[model samples]
Target: MTVIAFLGAIGPLVFIHELGHYFAGRLFGIKSDVFSIGFGREITGWTDRRGTRWKIAWLPLGGYVKFAGDMNAVGEPDAAWLALPAADRARTFQAKPLWQRAIVVAAGPVVNLALAVLILAGFAYGYGVDRTPAIVDSVIAGGPGAAAGLRQGDRILSIDGRSIDSFSELARFAQIRPAEQVAVTINRGGHRFVRPLTIGVERQRDRFGNEYRIGRIGIASGSPVLAPVGLLEAPIAGVRMTGGIIRGTFDTLGQVISGRRSIEELGGPIRIAKISGEQLSLGWAAFVWLVAMLSINLGFINLLPVPMLDGGHLFFYAIEAVRRRPLEPRVQEWAFRGGLAAVLALMLVVTFNDLGAVGLWQRLAGLIG
Candidate 1:
């Protein structure tokens, strides 16, 4: 079940992402030599009339589109391929204008983001927004809400001047603003007033042993209510949801980099596979929602200015635009090597964390003991 769910979830994402780059390259007359859905040995493949080898590889961690004249999947320029005849060179990726190449490089992540937005929009259209009012049922003593004069039966009106329609909205708003002071408005006894409070920090551990630090305001909600979304409003809701996810991701990463959050919170392929299976057990809707979130994360990660990624190519193109020529091949090679090392180190760390989350280390120790 785990393997099946993981493949089902990641297969479409990888294919769609590579297709984005493929189509964008085709638009500018650049030919792709390979369109692979994985990194390693080919499990099965076929060559198309256009001469592109479409394949499913053994390693399912990621995929790539290798354009003609590129040294590898990262799109590094190949000197030998560059020396091809004029007609052959014309259809190669390196032969295109710098702007065109940049677009082709960026198309993958952009398409991933677009996919997330479309999925979220479809969900909003089918189901509605959460309409549970932000009514406080209880407030824990000595907590942030209690300290701020909040009490039972108080209805939250807004936070930081933004209207809060549901308890979920209020909770989400507070969760992202951990330990930060915010003005929250509430109505009690038919009178409304604004109260400033510093949201408390809470460290929580999930059943999978993954830890997270989130904001806690010391209040609980009654129950959830669903409200139907209008056709016209669904797209807007989707865009807003995607934007929120992007912002939250940035905030979490910033905290991780700053040492405010534990690095154990970062998970790699193993954790994703486990969660994918769990969500699949819950039902298709939950699984698809998880997929949308992962899509957003995929797009954001690829856009970072790290070498060997789409953003890296764009970064190089930006420099070429300024200097009117590409960087020296030797320098680019060294930079790519460093980028590969950094990426590999991160992967190892995340994998270690995932193993720990699953209690692999403990099991090993028990056997040795």
Candidate 2:
């Protein structure tokens, strides 16, 4: 079951991710030679009338598309591809308009996000949702919650005197009320604590020089019972879920970047398998959350400006857009090799860490005895 689920999760997620790039490339009128859902020798395949060979490969760990003049099966341009005639190279990726190339590069992550949103919506509609009522899990140390006189285990009764029956409402109040002082009412123990507190919101900068806003209440809470809202309500919940997951992901990334967290905390495939296994035991709701969380991670990771990644491709596109020409093919190839090496090293490290997290090394230790 664990193996099945781990395979299932990665297979579909990867397919959808790559499909985004493939479809978007075609949408912009780029030609493709192959659109495979997995790697290695073909298990089953069909040639479209247009000569695109679609296949399900044996090694299903990941999949990719072969664009016209793709230097590699993964759709990257190669040196030999550069030797092709200019007319032949027109169908090549490097020949595409800068904007079209960027869209093709960006679409994979975008599709992952879209799949997550839809998954969330469907999950919410099927199983209902859990929301936290205006509840204080704990007061932040000198943070807004603490400054507002919130107490330990206090259920946030209201914020700014607005009646909030749900934590969603309280959270909305928190996000939009950035840097504003508000009266917070909480039930601590058997007593109520009310304090006027000035709340502070955190700010983050993005790749495009855009900024994002977030509430800075340093605490956690139990999810309230979200009785099944109507079908219409689930989509809203899903959208909110997507946004919240993205926000939390960015916060964690920021922490990692700012040295507030250790890189050792990062996990790779082993961690994902363990998590998927655990979620399988917990049932579908847990499974869906795992999918959404991983989907976000997939989206974010692909958007990273690494040379062999979607983000890396986009970075080149950005450079090309500025320079009015693509990087020299040799330069791009060398950059890709360096990036691939870095990626492999990172993978080994994360896999080791993940194995440690799951006590696999320890288990093997016991086996050695």
Candidate 3:
């Protein structure tokens, strides 16, 4: 059941991502030769009326749409496409205007982002929002909050001039800025005052034994309040939530790059599968939320300005627009080769980390002994 749930979570996302490319190509009159829901040998497939071959392959990990003028899934132009008669060449992807080509290539990630927003909006409308006001119920004795003169029942107004709506917001803000002094505002008996306090740093470990550091101020709040969301307001809330996730991701990446966070926190496909299975056990809503989060991640990763990615294609297009010519085919090919190698190396490292996280390495060592 866990395996099935994992596949179920990933398969639809891959399909949706590929469909974006397929539909956008069709819209721009660019011909596609194949639309596949996986890599490797085909298991079952059929040719559509538009002469495109649609298939399901053995590997259910990812999918792609092969445009007619492309050498492979990476969108390299080929000899066959070049040799096509002038009449048919007009329908090939490479023959389209640069803007059209860019749009078609970019549609995949855009669709993923849109899907995430819609899914999150739907959930918001159905389940409402959970919130806890930024009120201090108690301050830990001898902790930073106590040292900073914080008292019970004081309502937190803002942190570092950023308005705080909930206790979680304050904690999240503090957790990312350990050991730094921040200006905080509080409301006490119809009066407001600002206090500069240093956040206490603490090391934490997850269930998988991945460790990281977070800032704490030794404050606690009451139970969260549930607020009902209206029909029109749901999507607005969804957009806010999605934006927060994206910001948090970039911040974590920045921290890892700056040596403040460990790279061991990064996880690959195995980690995704484990998370999918765990989310499934929680219930359908949780599983769907996981899908939405994954969709956002997929969209954001593809938008990175690295060769062999959608953003890379758009990056080249930008150069073409400015120079009035495309880069040499050989140059593009070499760039893509380097990009592919980098992507594969990162994948291997993350997979190794995932194995260690799951105790697979220890089990193997025990068996060898």
What are the clashing pairs of model 3?
A: none
**Better model by TM-score: candidate 2 vs candidate 3:** 3
Pairs clashing within candidate 2: 131-224, 132-167, 135-156, 136-156
How accurate locally is residue 261 in candidate 1, as Cα lDDT from 0 to 100?
66
Question: What is the C-alpha local distance difference test score of each model?
Answer: 0.90, 0.77, 0.87
lDDT of 3 by residue, 66-114 (tens): 9988999777767687789997899999899999999898999999988
TM-score of each: 0.89, 0.73, 0.89
lDDT of 1 at 338: 88
- In model 3, which range of ten residues has the least summed lDDT? 205-214
What is candidate 3's TM-score against the reference? 0.89
- After superposition, which runs of candidate 3 have C-alpha atoms over 4 Å from their true positions? 153-163, 174-215, 367-369
Q: Is candidate 1 or candidate 3 better by lDDT?
A: 1
lDDT of 3 at 251: 78
Please, what are the lDDT tens digits per residue for candidate 2 over residues 117-139? 88898888887877666666666
lDDT tens readout by residue for model 1, 1-369: 888999998989989988999999999999889999999999999999999999999999999999999999888889977689999899999889998999998999999999998899899889887778899999999999999999999999998888887898788878866898889999999999999999999988875555677899999888778778888898888888898789779978997899866788789999999989888988999999999998999889999988898898899999999999999999999989988999999999999998987789989999999
